[model samples]
Target: MKIYFDYKVQDYLADESFRRWVLDGGFRNQDSAWSQWLLQNPDYAGEAMKARDIVLATQLTEEPFEEGYFDTIRRETMGAIQVKRRFVRPLWWQAAAAVVLVSGLLGWLVFYQAPSPETEVATQENVPAENVPFFQKNTSSAILPVALPDGSSVLLHPHSELSYHYGPAGTREVQLTGKAFFEVLKDPASPFLVYSGEMVTKVLGTSFTVTAYATDADFSVVVKTGKVAVSAPKEKNEATPGNADNQTTIHLVSNEQLFFNREKAHFKRREINQRDMLQYVPATHYAYAFEDTPVAEVFRQIGKAYGLDIDMEESLFSGCELTTNLTDEPLFEKLSIVCSAVGPGTSFVVEEGRIKVLSKGCNQ
Candidate 1:
């Protein structure tokens, strides 16, 4: 674990144990050494995720990358002269084919690094300082995609209303009167919060669905990925011991759901079945599947459905195809599966609030 203290995204991607944990495809890497290290140093999670994408994209190829092959690729990217090479390992030649796009993949995947503790997200960038406000009502027949000030995203259901503002305190807050699905960007400094009548759902970053209708007696929150905390008024909702504020907060992680009664100010938490998650969200938006679909078309469909921009070099996947049900899995997992299906030397990374696919393309 101490050895990984200085590991960057590229360093982690080049490691075998790190690749093994990512290839395992399980969210909880409880038994992995790196996982234990991460538990001790949580700040490196962003870097870990960036490296995971590179691992998963090129993971299908069992051949090991040449020692410091990426350093060579970086030199090549900078137009370094071709020097006489010595073989440190086998299969480096085959992987070099991916260098064409690895440069872009590396630079674009810097992602959202954790800001210094002293500096916080204003969310009111290029706007009035008076808590830049945005109110959106999805009056259309289809789901509406709304971008928030804090780089978070919302998939508002039809007829749902969303109003949010980021004040001087730096907290990104939203008030919802109806149902909506939120895909929050991870920001530890500033908490992202959603208020629905008497219930409040808070998260540092995660994806979740909240159905809080004013007409209905109950409001529910379903976490799609990551964790969230729900604070609601209970009949005897006294403050917990050591809590300065008189609030009863319920913590929920993946596979957990919360149902809060607005009338009685009571709430119930339960473990949710993955298959039934669609019922909690708008089916038209959450329910999507592709069968025998070309990889390019699949990327476009996912981009359109989730209201995200997926920049891909279509020519690469000309011969690639996929077939799967895109349900329950978080957005990142969906991309991982697609890259794995296209064979090896393929991967995707998030950058500038969108997705970019990097690959060596497919063999004819």
Candidate 2:
């Protein structure tokens, strides 16, 4: 998932997903990310709403694709090695976006990188040449999707770099120069090794993010699912005083993160559950079902699960009860369904980075 918090009005207007969500009334399904984003980053809501309005208004009116549109955008993008962050309005987004869609270049927003000047992207049919080392860089403003030779995958953050090599015994080794999220295919026979300048992360089958910039003094690893073992040089481990364990490797599980200071050679691990925000939080992470449960209580569980602060008058919904299985629905749809069960004149809204439940009264 791309970083939604960093997006401005123009960014949202330029995004096909956001535009599709707005125009298709698709807030109830996987497109609920927009609602979740609005709830998490309220500061961007006004701009998002404005962009939403523009999409609904101008995008609805079908516009013709002007010639030279593709070449113009590609030329502009290729010239800038470092795409500067911009906070501006989209002047002619509708027509240009339609052109990109019609031409089947929807992936123009993101491009893969190679060591040389050219862009290299691997597909199911066209895999990267084996035994030939190649570099993948995220030169665009969005995260770049990387498909490794193995079933393993990676989400390379913007400006990050990665290169992989096959080792003996079928082991997989990759060197990372910046932040990136990795989801390795489970292969007990072949262990995956990520070499971050300061430390190395090894995993049999896991999902995690490594942030270790060459110029930065601090490095970190956060595990999302499965296990990760981080190990540094013996000198770096033994340098820190008072570490009686003399352990050079630190193992981390899900929701746990490890931080290392390159200067001090000190390692600190912290549990990150409340504030660790990602652009996409799968609804299936937690199964939510109700058996004649109070509406207020249900909302509270959802709020805590999603790390959302829900503002509601508990007393107002005290009399309302709901019983249903909501294991597979997106968050906003769950809320809408619950509101309907609680009776009329009741609903929810995203306000100021929180969810506010509006109710006239509970069902009598």
Candidate 3:
């Protein structure tokens, strides 16, 4: 009768009150009591919903055994018991012994089911028979490298755990409980997916970093190379077979990042700063100075250096030129100087980590 707020999905399934609430559609007073409790504890809603789905999926609609099955079981069990004892008891005692044997046999029959040949073959084909669950916990002082079965690698941070199954499949999936950097091997056919709490990060063959801990208030995914798709997990009813279209998905290219607010369920996209890139791309011999440089080329260099995308009206800046001796200023400072040099009415706006250039043509 006492249900803790921290109970997991399995715990909810095992609770008699919880089962009654779910099976009866929460109509009774007892059901309403549990429902009110869930409303008061919003954090438990997700687990309760999952447990409800499991119960519904596995609910028995009818008796498993066919007609006359129990009669046959009763007869067989009584014969076995009589043969084992090999002694004649009183008629009443013999009948009572048979009833006890039948009850025990019925209990076993209810809990166990022998799969048919077709069912066994179907299970082997659909389920991952060859793949076994693999788990790695990084408790070391330094970052640990985990080699996956698909030739991809993950650099797990300290206090983090990563789990996945290994098999020859077209899709690779992993679950993470903390921060980790992934370098996935190229397999266009088999996309790699990482599940972290409410969000799911997916990629074909890319390098990325994910920070998502149960204790953290926010979750983040940063793409270092290639493309990644981040989205919330689809509800059970919304997940269609063989359909990959995710309406909530946000596609990210290299140098982009997605931040998810756990409480609000909001997603904010941003570009990675240049200072953060220093660790990935070492300082090269490239110069930041531009002397009558084409506007397109200037923007290209800045985008490449900082891992950003600069959106501009190419026709407007077709013949435009920029002349400035840019230093190691912040990214926005450099953009301010560029916009000012372009024209008097020229301006730029930053939204969703991409810079949008607005200008009234240099010729005007």
Best-matching candidate per TM-score: 1
Ranking by TM-score: 1, 2, 3
Query: What local distance difference test score does each model get?
Result: 0.67, 0.65, 0.66
TM-score (C-alpha) between model 2 and the true structure: 0.42
Worst 10 residues of 2 by lDDT: 80-89
- Residue-wise C-alpha lDDT for candidate 1, range 38-111, written one tens digit per residue: 87778877798889877767745478875666874574334212111211223643354244223222222222
Give candidate 2's total backbone clashes: 0
The most accurate candidate by lDDT is: 1
TM-score of each: 0.48, 0.42, 0.39
- Residue pairs in steric clash, candidate 3? none
Tell me the deviation in Å of residue 256 in model 3: 0.8
**Model 3 agreement with the true structure over 1-364: per-residue lDDT tens digits:** 4766779999989998888888888823544978788877888889988988888888877858655567745854564454335224335444444443333222222212212433433333433455645677877655554545455656677799988864366579999999887777657788899999989898877678899989988898887766799997445466676677533688887678788887766788999886784444323222365778888778777756555567888788887776655543334444544654554455555433246766687623
Error of 3 at 243 (Å): 12
Question: Per-residue alpha-carbon lDDT of model 2 for 1-364, expressed as tens digits?
Answer: 5778777789999999998888788655543878887777788789888988888788445687655667645743443221111111134433433332222221211122233323333332233334445467777765555656554656677788999876766678899998887777667788999998868899987678898888879898988766789987556535566665554799887778898888777789988873572532221242355877988898888766545557898989776777755532234545655665565456665433346778776752
| Global CA lDDT computed for model 1 | 0.67
Candidate 1 vs. true structure, TM-score = 0.48
